[model samples]
Target: MEMIVHNPTEGIYAATDDFVHAIEVRSPSRFLFIAGTMGLDSDGVPGTTLEEQLELIWANLRVILAEAGMSVDNIVRLTSYLRDPSYAEANAKARVAALGGRRVPTTAIVAQTLASGWLVEIEVVAAG
Candidate 1:
């Protein structure tokens, strides 16, 4: 499979011949796309800190991957949104601790909450 990232103003998939400008992901197995996830827990409340929120997101990711008989190692890509882009370094450290490496999905860092007072939203794609 392949992954394509396009500029919003380029009329959808109007990729230029500059292949190097697009990020492509390919694997020999299945492709998985996860729904956007928020900081709220299974109990429906925000996690305590940025680290705590990342932990919950990681847990949720595990459950989702397990339900499909896979794990984070099979993940090919991930996309995350943060309420504050300035927190990226901290979030990255937390994510590294969770994934045991610094492998990040083709990601974007934005500063806006999906819901008021929320700090992060994460979605992922995996293949192996």
Candidate 2:
């Protein structure tokens, strides 16, 4: 599949280096819509801190993507639900690291998590 990024120069606010306004996928043979993923380990335990959770979340995402025969490069979009707004920067950095600096359409929102100690939840859309 071919991914085309959309970030117009003048019509709206420019997108930051970490994310684009949108991604257009063309001729994708498969699409993977990952559900909200938390920073849970293989044994289903939440990480104690936001940073730990971010690390686990990315590792978990890698496994999930691999199960679908995809990798971080297949990620076309990402949405992060953060327990606090302050976690946004860390989350963005983790995302960039996971995707090897490849930017895509992304969003992050501060909100309460369903479970205690769950600092963040991430969902992804991948096409390949």
Candidate 3:
């Protein structure tokens, strides 16, 4: 599949280079909409630290993508929710590592809280 990132010249640019304004997937044979994944482990234990939680969230996303025979590169869009503004940097760092520098269309929102002390939650849309 060919994924095109669109950043129109007339629109405001993203604050970070990690994402584009929009994404277009061409001739997708299949599409996957992943639910908001939290920073919990297999045993239902939430990570204690922001960094730890971010890492776990990425790991969980990777597993979900793998199960669908996809990878981070197949992702066309990403949405993230964070409990605190302080966790933004950590979240970006973890996302960069997880995506391996592939900048897909993304949206991030800062929220008050999440269930079970999760610092972050991520949702993805992939096409292949």
Candidate 4:
């Protein structure tokens, strides 16, 4: 599939360098709409810290993507639900590391998590 990054220089506010305004995928054979995944351990326990949660989230995402015959490179969009707005920088860093510095369209919002310990939740859309 051909992924097109759309970051218009005019007619809209400029998006941060870490993410683009939108992504347009062309000729994708399949699409995977992953649910909001949290940084839970093997025993399904949420992480106590944002860093730990981010780590687990990316690891879990790798496994989930692999199971669907895809990888982080196939991710066209992502949204992060952060328990605290302060976690945004860490979340962005982790996402960049997970995708090997290849930025796709992304959004991060400060919100409360259902689970007390889950500092962050991430949902992604992948195409292949």
Q: Which candidate is the best by lDDT?
A: 2
Residue lDDT tens for model 3, 59-92: 8988999999998889888888988778778888
Clashing pairs in 3: none
- lDDT per residue (tens digit) for residues 1-128 in model 2: 78888888797998898998988999999999999999999999998988899999999999999999999999999999999899999999999998999999998988889987899999999999
What overall lDDT, based on C-alpha atoms, would model 4 receive against the true structure? Answer: 0.92
Q: Score residue 38 of candidate 3 by CA lDDT.
A: 90
Instruction: Please give the lDDT score at residue 91 for candidate 2.
Output: 95
- Which parts of model 3 are misplaced by more than 4 Å? none
How well does each candidate superpose onto the true structure, as a TM-score? 0.73, 0.97, 0.92, 0.96
Writing each residue's lDDT as its tens digit, candidate 4 over 45-124 gives: 87778899999999999999999999999999999999898898999999988899998999899998897788999999
- Tens-digit lDDT track for model 1 on 7-113? 44455554232212334565456778898777678987988788778888888888989999888776666777888877677766766676677354446578668
Whole-model lDDT per candidate = 0.70, 0.93, 0.85, 0.92
Select the stronger candidate by TM-score from 2 and 3: 2
Candidate 2 Cα outliers beyond 4 Å, as residue runs: none
Q: Cα miss at 11, model 4 (Å)?
A: 2.0
For model 3, what is the error of residue 100's alpha carbon versus the real structure, in angstroms, after optimal superposition?
0.6
The 10-residue segment of model 3 with minimum total lDDT is: 9-18
Give the winner by lDDT: 2 or 4. 2
